[model samples]
Target: MTETVKLKNITIVLNQPRYPENIGAAVRAMRNMGIDRLIVVDPRDYDLEKIRKMATHGCLDTVAAIQRQTDLKAALESFHYVIGTTARLGGQRRTGKPDATAEKIVSISQENQVAVVFGREDRGLSNEELRLCHELVHIPTAEFSSLNLAQAVMIMCYELFNACVPSKPAFTPRMAQRRELDAMLDQLRDILIRISYINPENPDYWMHHLRQFFTRIQARAREVSIIRGLIRQVDWYAEKRYRDGRRDERNRIMGKGAAECD
Candidate 1:
């Protein structure tokens, strides 16, 4: 039987994996879930024999097809949306923002070329590396949150595998892409600055909150277009009113000077 074509578009990336065995086992997990693309970033020099020995079953083909990259950023360059798997928060992550779950990850994967990054075996992802991701995900564990690298890959794949079955009611809105959303936000930032909604001295602070609020809302592309159009309208009206007010003030002054002459 031919392999199922589920999750055909999702690319799995392993970053700085230390063990050949884990790589081998990850192939099996991927093959089991019909995930064909595997990207490895700066992995240790591993013996293919060691990898093959650990990759039991008919998963050798998956092992053979692994793509190598010098760094995680290079590996993920093509994917528009990336999800980083980490239990701990790092860098400039907003405080107390909950992680996107497996379901949430799968939800975005429907329309986007999603790349899910698994960090190094020893320390997980560095804060700088995590910044590359659009979101972070964690598998909920009771006592021990740290899952084995292969185990983590398996869990994510399994969840994706189960969740990716053809959608039933089919009324889901097309989610806005990062590029599109970022463009709208850019326009919004300019309008906000024009209106003085953003503090001139600390624009980043105001924008940071607005970004968080909109990111939380997860608005659709159509929805974001509406918001952007509204901002344009507000700017248009504000300028018009300012011009009209200036004209009326000039007329009043001219009339007062005529009365004084009389």
Candidate 2:
């Protein structure tokens, strides 16, 4: 059958937003949609007088509790997947990958924490920042497709708010949290290093790819535990084999044998 992940599961992340008015309006858009979390990355200092004035009534708490991060990547760490808004289409789109619509975003949220990222008013999301996103969405518009920052936020928020209804799917498993997923990734990375599958000095080579791999799948909490258990077993075997191999070589070199035989 179908499941439902409500609008509460959604988050709005603004990257380097320059305008206090736009930020205030974004708060209203999110509040209107029943989405509460607001994460702003490297925001410029704006006068509270202007911001609160634009925020209107009942939105001050959101402005106060709003999270601030140094950059987009840091802001995105806790999310299972990022839906970055971008108008530019080059580096990432070189493979001809198209942007996702809001419906697809909702569908993916069935078992993942979805962060909808809007870039700065001047440049939109940088190409480097866009790479961190699991997918991108470009709101369709007439000629002069560039939309105002608040307008972009409003449209994306509207879609997610509405999509939480009958269209939402039914998911039985409790989804894995950010820290739990990171734990599994760390465990697997350690095992891979023990087995010579990955380099210890540069762990992120495969770790980054692994993160990308996991983001696509709607892996549940139980699934993450299962994978960690499996990795532990593999680690045990790899270490046991490697020790035996070392002992065998030493025995061959000397006229002696291993103290503990395999």
Candidate 3:
């Protein structure tokens, strides 16, 4: 049964990718690693015909199955666990040590659908986008933040392929999905707003800082989900109170007692 396990359940999500050759090379990487699915979100919309030549033979099927999404968050929701690639480090980004990252990937990759995401060559995944992922993978390099898109794709897929074939460990768990994490972030933002810790108009300013804080913890999906559930319960009670208070005010104005209204 372990031998039957495939890396095919993997989805490589490229966000706003600008180059066609990179897309072609990513397809080739997927082919090499036995990953057939590709999801490109709002890419530069390069000519697939031109890119096909770069994929060589027997790998165009990956390009054929490629699905374009309007955004990264939407593309990632179908995946149970998402790992975002970054070059930045020291704050929430998994840095230095391929062995540790490989173990992390295999542990999560073994259970359910997983998507490894990369951002545009220029800016990389935004802080908000990174928050949607379960963990971050920062490829180690020398004194530079830059990496070629296709090269990064190849390295990551290669690492993951190595993790898959060895069957390293017992499967651990299915993590919180992208949507669940997004919901938690939204609630956390709302709570911060309520506490006056963050201004609604400039919420992202604080959120980005907060995101850096959370990433360092390398939270498991269950842990984050538990926090989200607690936040929702609090939000629900607060909202119920606000609405009831409004009803009471209306009752008093209409000469119907609040108790009678209730």
lDDT of 1 by residue, 1-262 (tens): 1221138768889999999898888887887877878888899866788788787758777778888899776677566566788867545564221232545545555555777789888898887676556677766678757678988888878777765334442233555655666677778888888888887786666776677566666667788789888988998998999999999999999999999999
Q: 11-84 in candidate 3: lDDT tens per residue?
A: 88899989888898888877887778888999886778866977877787777878989978788876777778
TM-scores of the models, in the given order? Answer: 0.62, 0.73, 0.76
Q: In terms of TM-score, how similar is model 3 to the real structure?
A: 0.76
Root-mean-square deviation (CA) per prediction? 6.5, 5.1, 5.3
Worst lDDT run of 10 residues, candidate 2, spans 91-100
Among these predicted structures, which one has the highest TM-score? 3
Residue range with the least summed lDDT across 10 consecutive positions in model 3: 1-10
lDDT of 2 by residue, 130-239 (tens): 65666677776777776889888888887776553353354434456655676788898888887788889999766776776774575677898999899988888888
Please give the CA lDDT of all the candidate structures. 0.73, 0.74, 0.75
Best by lDDT: 3
* Model 2 regions more than 4 Å off: 1-5, 71-81, 90-101, 104-113, 126-132, 164-168, 186-210, 256-262
